[model samples]
Structure formats: structure tokens, C-alpha cells
Target: MRIGELAQRCGTTTRALRYYESLGLLTARRSANGQREYDESDLRLVAQIRSLTDIGFALEDTRPFVECLRTGHASGDACPASVAVYRRKLAELEEFIGRLTAARDRVRAQLDDAERRSRPCKR
Candidate 1:
């Protein structure tokens, strides 16, 4: 298939495919006429990239999985590299949630203080 077919099948855009190529995450070959062409494997690769990026993973972060798929694995996450990315994403999400939790606590305290201050003074 061509870039357009691949993009439509993968639920992504041609511009995104080109960007993935630029990032070296995706690849294509040139047809006899010099137009970019792809195959079924390329379709799977783009799907893996889409799945990862849909859940907040950076485009770069998806490279390992794409490489894994290229290596004949059944699934992109079948390799150690993809596992490592999952670990890293978990750590990042944990830290982000921790920061948000702390901010929530502080906001709650401020709201409590304001509410107490607004109450009428009863001797």
C-alpha cells in the first residue's frame, strides 16, 4: 500500500507518518516511480505507534516497540526494550500523580482555612 492507505488503516495521518519517518520510528520504501510505499508489517508498526501515543507516550518513547515489531515479535511489547518503556512511563505517572495529590492537599487546607475565617465569631 501507499502512505495514504497506511495512514487510513492505522487511524493516523500522512503527516504523522512522515514525522515518524523523520524520527526514525517508522519507515517506508520507494516504489519504482519513487513514491513511498508500505506493506502489512508497516501497518502493524504504525498501529503500535498509535496505541502508545494515544495514551500520553511521546513519539520518541514508542521507538522501542516499533523496533520490537520489526524484529519479528508477535507483539511490540514482547521485548525487553518495550518493557523498559512501560517501567519508565509508570515512574513518570507516579511522580506526576504525587505532585497533583500534594497540590490537592494544599488547596484543601487553604479552603478549610478560608471557611473558618468566614464564619461568624461566637464568644
Candidate 2:
């Protein structure tokens, strides 16, 4: 397929496809007519990148996953590098969750104290 078709199929923009090419995440293959061409494998690659980014992975962070796909892995997370990225992302999410939980607890405590103070006093 052509670039436009690939973008449509991936539900992405042609500009984003070009950006991916520029980032070396995708190879810009040209047909004999000098137009960009892509095969099913390219579609798979874009899908991999999209899925990763949708889950909060940075564009740069998706490189290892893309490379894994390019290396013929059945899944993008099938390589050591991709696994390392997963581990790092998991740790980051865990830390953020902990902070959020603590903040939530503090807010709950404040609300409880305020409510108690606002209650009418017993005789």
C-alpha cells in the first residue's frame, strides 16, 4: 500500500508516518514510481508503535519494541530490550500510584477532620 493508505489503515496521519520514518523507527521504501510504499509488515510495525504509545510509552521508548518486531519476534515485547522497557515503565507507574494513594489518604483525613469540627456540639 501507499503512505496514505497505511496511515488510514493505522488510523494515524501521514505526517506522523513521516515522523516515524524520520525517527528511524520505520524505513521509507520507495516504489519504482518514486512514491512511498509499505507492506503488511509495515502495518504491523505501526500497530506496535501505536499500541505502546497508547499505553503511555514514550515515542523513543517504543524503539526497542519496534526493533524487536523488525527482528521477526512474534511479539514486540519478546526481546530483552523491550522487557527492560516494560520493567522501567512498571516501576514508574508503581511510584506514581504510591504517591497518588498517599495524597488521596491525606485528603481523606483532612476532609474527615473538617467534617468532625463542623458537627454540632453535644450538650
Candidate 3:
């Protein structure tokens, strides 16, 4: 397939595809005409990349999965490297959520305190 077909099938932009190529996440071979050419397997790789990035995974975090796919794994997460990335990401998200919850509680307490202070005293 060509770059355009791959992008359209993978629901990404040609620019993004080019960017992936630049990042070494995706690769292509030059045709006799010098146009970029990709295989059907590239589509699966793009889908994996999109899935990870959509859920807040960093581009670098996607490297393991892409490598797994390139090595003919049935799924990107099939490799130990990919699984390790998943674990790290999960831990990071849990820590982030904990901090967010604490911040929310602090903000709520401040709002309640302000409301109490603003109340008018009755005789």
C-alpha cells in the first residue's frame, strides 16, 4: 500500500505517518518511482500506535509495542517490553490520580471555609 492508503485506513494523517517514519516507529520502502510504500502489516502497527497515544501513552512508551509487532507478535502487548510499559504506565496513572484526589479535597475544603467565613451572623 501507499502512504495515503495506509494513513486513510489507519485513521491518521499523512503528516503523522511521516512523523512516525521519522521517529522509527513506522518504516517504508521506496518504490521504483521513489514513492514511499508500506505493507498491510503497517496498518496494524499504526492502529497500535494510535491506541496507545489516544490513551495518554507517550510516543516513546510506544516503542516496545512497535518493536513487538515488527518482530511478528500477534499483539503489540505480547512482548515483555510492552508489558513492562503497561505496568509502568498504570503505576504512573495511579500516582497521578492520588495527587489529583488530594488536590480536589484541598480545593473543596477551601471553598467550604470561604463559604463559612462569608456567612452573616444573626442576632
Candidate 4:
């Protein structure tokens, strides 16, 4: 398939596909006429890239995992360094979630207090 078809199938823009290719996360073949050609494997790779990115993994971080997958590694976690990277990412995510939860609780309390103040006082 071409870039347009791949973009439509992935529910993304052509520019995004190009960006992924540039990041070395996706691979494409050059046609005889110089247009890009993609295969089913490329589609699956794009889906993996999207999922990892949605989960807060940066492209740089994802590259090693993707390489491992492509090289038929038994498991990314088997590599000690990869495990360390994942652990770091998980810790960062936990801290971010904690901060966001605290902010949400503070906002909820403020909203509740505002609502109570807005109610008419009982005689």
C-alpha cells in the first residue's frame, strides 16, 4: 500500500507516517517510480508505535524495544538494561499520576465549597 492508504488505515495523517519513518520506527520501500510502498508488517509496526507513544513512551525509548522485536528477541524484559528503562518509566508515570490525582482532589474540594457557599442560607 501507499502512504495515503496506510495513513487512512491507521487513522492518522500522512505527515505522521512520514514522521514515524523519519524516527526509524517505521520502514517503507521505494517503488520503481520513487513512491513509498508499505507492507502488512509496516501496518502492524505502526500500530505498535502508536500504542507505545500513547502510553507515554518516547520514540527514543521505543526504538530499542522495536529493534528487539524485529530481531526476534524472546522478550524485551529479558535484557537487564531494557528492564531498567521500563522501571524508570514506570516510576515517572507513578509520580505524574500522583501529582495529577492531588490536583484533581484539590479542585474537587474547591468546587464543593463553592457550591455550598452558593446555596441559599436557611432561616
Q: Where does candidate 1 stray beyond 4 Å?
A: none
Reference-based TM-score of each model: 0.95, 0.93, 0.98, 0.69
Per-prediction CA RMSD (Å): 1.0, 1.2, 0.6, 3.4
Error of 1 at 114 (Å): 0.6
Comparing candidate 3 with candidate 4, which one achieves the higher TM-score? Answer: 3
Can you tell me which runs of candidate 3 are displaced by over 4 Å? none
Q: Which is superior by lDDT, 1 or 4?
A: 1
lDDT for position 116 in model 3: 98
Candidate 3, residues 6-115: lDDT per residue as tens digits? 99999889999999999999999999999999998999999999999999999989999999999999999999999999999999999999999999999999999999
Query: Local distance difference test, per candidate?
Result: 0.93, 0.96, 0.96, 0.81
Clashing pairs in 3: none
lDDT of 1 by residue, 1-123 (tens): 999998898888899999999999877899999989999999889889888889999988999999899999999999999999999999999999999999999999999999999999999
Query: Is candidate 1 or 3 superior in TM-score?
Result: 3
Compute the lDDT of residue 68 as modeled in candidate 3.
Answer: 99
Each prediction's total of clashing residue pairs, residues at least 3 apart in sequence or on different chains, is 0, 0, 0, 0
